[model samples]
Target: MKQLIILTLASLFFTASAAADEALTAEVLKEKSLAMCESKASVLPEGEKAEALAVCQCVAENTNYELILEAKKSGDDSVAKQHMEETLKTCKAEDASIGS
Candidate 1:
């Protein structure tokens, strides 16, 4: 039937659109993460500046992009905040060990 064919095509179009949106969201998250790291790193003290930058980079590189996207989609920040806190804690611990 023509209606069935039209429905199938529409479904495919929606699926493709969703995939593209997900990819765009991922790219946006990556850019945001890097920008956040750069801004945070710029304000660190000279003595621990490198370590601080390293921590930020570590956090950015290790964060779960999918979790961030899910949180954003649901309008809930808890997942994203939890990820950030965990990343910071882990990175800080690593940085402390480096200075030891």
Candidate 2:
């Protein structure tokens, strides 16, 4: 039936869309990690800075932190803004010095 055909097509479309989302999410996370590392690497003091940089690197590598990654990659300004707020909160909570 036409209805059955339409449903199958719809399912395929949604599945493909989800896969694309996952791929984009992964790409965004990778970019965010690299950026975080680079940013920390730039400002951290020589010896003490190494510890901060390591923390950032650990956060970049260890956490899911996927939502911000998605928002940033999608170029959604509102989402990006919200994500930034959340990220700042996380930094403050996890490492107070991060807020500085």
Tens-place lDDT per residue, model 2, 1-100, is 2222223223322332354466655555545554646654665456555545544544444444455445545755466445444543464355656545
Top candidate on lDDT is: 1
Compare the candidates by TM-score and give the number of the best one: 1
Q: Which stretches of candidate 2 lie over 4 Å from their true place?
A: 1-28, 31-43, 58-66, 69-75, 97-100
Clashing pairs in 2: none
Question: How many residue pairs clash (N, CA or C atoms closer than 3 angstroms) in each of the candidate models, in the order given?
Answer: 0, 0
lDDT of 2 at 28: 56
Scanning candidate 2 in windows of ten residues, the lowest lDDT window is: 1-10
lDDT of 1 at 33: 58
